[model samples]
Target: MSIKKPLDPGQEAVSLCQHHPREELCYSCSDCDGSLACPECVTSTHQGHTLVKLKNTPDFVWKKLIEHYIQKAEKFEIPKILKELKFAEGKLEQNRKHYQELIGVVQQRGEELKEAIDRITMRHVNTITEVAKENTVYIEYYQGELHSLHTEIIYALRKCHQANDTEDFSVVLDSEKIIRAGLKLPRVPITQTTKYRMGPSPLPLLESAFGGVEIVGYRPKQLGPTVPHVVQKKLEKPEPPKPALYSVVSEFRHLTDITSLVPTEDVYSWISNEEKKEVVLLDRAGDVKQTTGLSLHIRDICTSPITNNLWCCSEYDYSVREMTTPTNTEVRLNFPFVPRALALTHNEDVVVGTFRKVCVYNMEGEEQFMASADKLGRQIVASPQHISVCPTSGNVAVVDWDEQSHDGNGSPCVTVLTSDLQLLFQYRGPQTRALRSGKSRASSTRKNKKEPPPSFWPTDACYDAAGQLFIAERTSKSVQMVSNDGTFMRNLYTDQEFSPKTVGVQTGGFLWIGFDFGIVKVIKYKQ
Candidate 1:
């Protein structure tokens, strides 16, 4: 409870404790709330207290303060603010460009609609005019016949009057001729009146055609607090447990040439065969729920997350069909190129993989975006055979193959892209050493001497609940699992006899895999 007086600028840099005015202050007492103490004060008033020597305190305190300042300046205060500013500026520029493009699209669509309206109006006008002209021609011919009959009647009447006065017999004969002409009066042309039948207003349709804009709020990147060098050296986090196949849950047979398999929220899956042009819905117990026969051969099939409607792709007709029931189906979209794969995103957007591009469409069948090439204008995919969308991240994964390779199998890779169509990464199988290490020695040595190890030919892909990608490799006869960040994690399953053609991951940790020989095996997995 002592009050120390402030020292003057000219005063010496040494202080005496208030209680011990004769003794110099040489210690700071922690128990007394960091109060300065003299040797006599520590022993008498603040005994058994933690004390820091005043002579040694300057180095430790000043050094800590300097380090804190340096860290704030280097890590958070200066660099973070600068980076955030740059990011905001870049975002603004991107927004400007995006809106500008939208405006251009609206203007172009307006012009096209106007031109179409004009053409339709002119066509209707011409049709009405032509019909009116034909009707007028018939009316004119009838009027001419009536005029001729009137003239004959007038002549016959004048001749009859002369015959009455001068006794002429020829006048009666002329009257008879006039009567015959009048009896053959031309049949009155029954002209049907033409009028315009107006249709419903196009306001609602126009509003849908010119889709509304979606404004997404900007979210700044979050940065963690800067840690000191000493505190940063902590134990590493343990790796996540690798996924393992627990058991074969079920086996489905009787379906021929199963090209695609899509699992629904329930214990059911939809499978299709291109050769038979049939789509069958079956439960986990291998019981067929429904069967649908389509005219167009199905290339792939996917179920909507929201409505659970089946979306089927037809390569032969270059179209996609949406089926609500076994008998109710409608053409969802028609593409210029063949649609090889189909997938529905978390938002229920339809994703179709074609010859060299993947296109994303809203449920209304309007194109939202497309990805075919990289930012550098280089071709990203020669042929997108299969497509999958991550449920959590909305990221798109395409199994692309080089269709023009010397061997028909072609080199295949999985191209991962962000929801916005930005390129994330491409995974071209794992290293050869990693593959060999996974196989047993006997299996590795049993390979044909002439035939080398088959190359990676990914045919289909799907994302698990944990965002891990499961890709089915046709030539390798294995299903590869990739981490969310595009790292090759490991092989989930391998079969030496049958090649994997398609893969589907259900909600309850079940993986449904389809082979080329029309067999589907459902396996339960654990992480």
Candidate 2:
């Protein structure tokens, strides 16, 4: 401390002020004369001299200067301005849509009013014109009576003078016919009647009792298209400006990963009156965190035609999973890993629909068949459960999403394949018109063009014991029954309101219908 240079009053006292950034712990000397120092600076000088503080000191001035710069940067930020602009644009679009709706309503009301006025006017005009024609006949009769008059006419002339003028003939007209004609006038129902003048009698029938030319009410004219219907656009208050932030645009999908779905309580069993046996239980076991129920993600399950140990799946797992149980009544082929859809061969070899190709597997966990990469080009949307497979002589008959998915959701047709899985022909069901015109092709067998009835959306399909295809339509809320050779048959629904998710056949046309909340149906054939 003694070796340190002493600060002098004549020279600059190099120290910071009390108002510096770290001033809370600064605790500097009161008379330090810290012109060149920070607020944390301490000093031993200015012990007892009369001190005068600077007005609008440099520390305060520097703080204000930094704050001014920050405020300027905040005003010019792009994100802040862009946010306000977007809000304004969104409000304007909403106003436009609202105004458009109001304009449509007003236009419709105007048209309705115009048509009503036209109908009433035609009937009223015809009735009024007939009354005017009848008055002409009455005037002719009065003139004829005057021509046949004798010296009695002199007395009639004196009576006419007493009545005021001869030409002013005001006699009370008899009008039973015209009064009946007024009764025939069309009645117009008016809504919201206020400030409108209506005749006290509603007709000219009481004109005889009143005996004066009195105007009862005004009639409305027919409305025309020239009338401009006005609808004001409701303007809203402008939203506030936002703080600035950085942003960038990217193309790839950032969709959220879908975790396991939680199972809901409550299931109901459905049955036909003929069978009377409850096959599908509402509260099926093994869905939640438990054993003895079915495995996870098993949408639709089908037993293999060749072996009792093998089964295929479409909804739950990607590849086929086989059970290694000793009894072997269980499912036993877990080979393909991630099979969205699966079909069994007559020998129980599994054919699975994958992301790009159809991977065929044997019971020994070997890849027996791998189709070409373009075997199903661009057909995998929503990751490939969308394609339905109908297996034939060791090969696959595929109906992909390439056509009906992109163009329409309707079931287009099933493609047949040979033993080598070559495309043989496209079968549009037995009903041609329904296939082309969107009618239920499987429901009707008619050969002509007809109005279509409601149908199903087939997502996954397989054949039953009768060599018939049971198609699980995603949207039809039912399964379509078709022959294995690809002829349209009928539709199967578990319940009237239950939507069909996945379908498979075990034996005797025994089909399993999958619905919501882990409930599956075991159906028995009726006819």
Winner by lDDT: 1
RMSD of 1: 20.4
lDDT of 1 by residue, 1-527 (tens): 24446588776556777777778888877676466789998789889999988778888764664676687779888988999999999999998998899899979988988898899999999999999999999899889988997787778788878888989777678487665555566688878688563443356577887677776797444324464645444433457896556678987665477777899887889888777777898888778899887887788888887788999888788888889777878987887878887888867778888776888988677899988766656555667777888876888898877454411134457878788777777777776322111122113232233444447778899987667889998877888888777768777888878999888999888999988777888888775
Model 2 ranges with Cα > 4 A deviation: 1-302, 310-319, 326-337, 363-366, 372-416, 425-456, 492-495, 517-521
> What TM-score does candidate 2 get on C-alpha atoms?
0.33
Q: What is the lDDT of residue 67 in candidate 2?
A: 71
The lDDT, on a scale of 0 to 1, for candidate 2 is 0.43
**Model 2 lDDT tens row, 350-400:** 666554345566777678766432244322221234223333334355544
Candidate 1 lDDT score at position 448: 31
In the predicted model 1, the residue pairs found to clash are none
